[model samples]
Target: MSLIILASLVFLLMPIFLLLYIRSYNRHKKNHFLEKLNMQQKFESEMLQTRVEVQDQTMQSIATELHDNVGQLLSLTTLTLNSVNLNDAEKAKKKIDNSLSLVNKSIKELRELAKLLHGEQLVENGIGHAIHQEINWLNKTGAYELKINNQLLDVQVTSPDKDLIILRLLQEIINNIIKHAQAKHIQIDSYLEKNALHLRVRDNGVGFDPNEIKVKKSGMGLNSIYKRIEMINGKLALNSAPGEGTSISIEIPYP
Candidate 1:
């Protein structure tokens, strides 16, 4: 009788244990689904923010180019035309020629500005070409000695969202250098290896302590870069010192 009772108990406990396990498994599945949904929402939010920042940066570049470049050229052309001595045919012809040259230069600048206006489209072309376009614009500034080895120009694979974020990250880094680095040389290298995309930027700028920046939550847009890299599951290694300059390396999974 005791043996029969023990077997009966064992059979009853088995169902309870199975029921508990099913309940626990279902709970875990629900939690995992919710966690995944939250992550998807966060990634979408970051992408939206990245899009806005890219647009804003493009607009700012356009405004600056218009004011500092096209506007100045047009103004000089106006002045030249105004000073033309129509009474002296030779002098009048010379001033008119100069004015025409200025107008042509202004047109060229406007065309370049138009290219910048299509910032989103540039990224759509290919991240490699987008990067080259950015470097060209920076080169035009003649602010730094640039050594570029961008091997992505012919790369066929792309991730549109990642491309935009990467471009903005580069822009932010260059902006930080322009505003605070006070360094004269900048080097950019980008390539693909071992199923990953790598980007490295080194500047001979007045560097700072990364630890101090983290503690103080100070400038250089380091925090922003970190957050974006995390969003894309990328890794960044930043090295810097007071007089040693700054170098940043980033690696991300590719398409």
Candidate 2:
């Protein structure tokens, strides 16, 4: 009689226990889904911010080129034409030729600037081509000795969003080098291997202790780089020490 009572109690409680278990499971499932949605939103927000920064950087570059380079060339061309003496055929011919040369150079620079204006489109072409364009711009500065071994130029596969982020990361790195590295030699290597894309940048610059930067919690745009790398689920290895050059290696899964 006692066993029968116990069995009846168990049977009566089974539905309540099952209902509680289902409720707990559903709650956990909903929470997990919400957490994922939040992460996706955050990633999208960061991407938008990155895009804006890239565009701003491009515009700043364009403005500087127009003011410091193209502007100067055009001004020189105008001055040369104004100084021309029409009565002296030979001298006038020389001045005209000089002005023509300046004008041609100005046109060339404007053409290059036009290409830069289409920074977004450049990434669309392919990450490799985008990188090549960036390297070409850096080379034009002639401030550093650059050794480049970029193997992505012919690569047909591309991740549009990743490409843009990667380009911006490169830009930030180059900016740091220009502003603070005080180094003369820069070596960049990029390639694809074993289903991962690898980028390595080494600079012979006055390096700083990475620990110091970490302690201070700011410097060299390292924080931004780390966040972006995390956003892409990529990895970055940075090595540097006082009086020693800095080297950064990054690996990301390819599309």
Q: Pick by TM-score: which candidate is best?
A: 2
TM-score of 1: 0.94
| Runs of candidate 2 exceeding 4 Å displacement | 214-217
Clashing pairs in 1: none
Q: Report the alpha-carbon TM-score of model 2 versus the true structure.
A: 0.96
Clashes of 2: 0
lDDT of 1 by residue, 1-255 (tens): 999999999999999999999999999999999999999999899989988998898898888889988999999999999999889999999999999999999999999889988998999998998899889878878789999999999999989999999998999888988998889999999999998999999999899889887676547788899889888889988889999899999999985
lDDT of 1: 0.91
TM-score of each: 0.94, 0.96
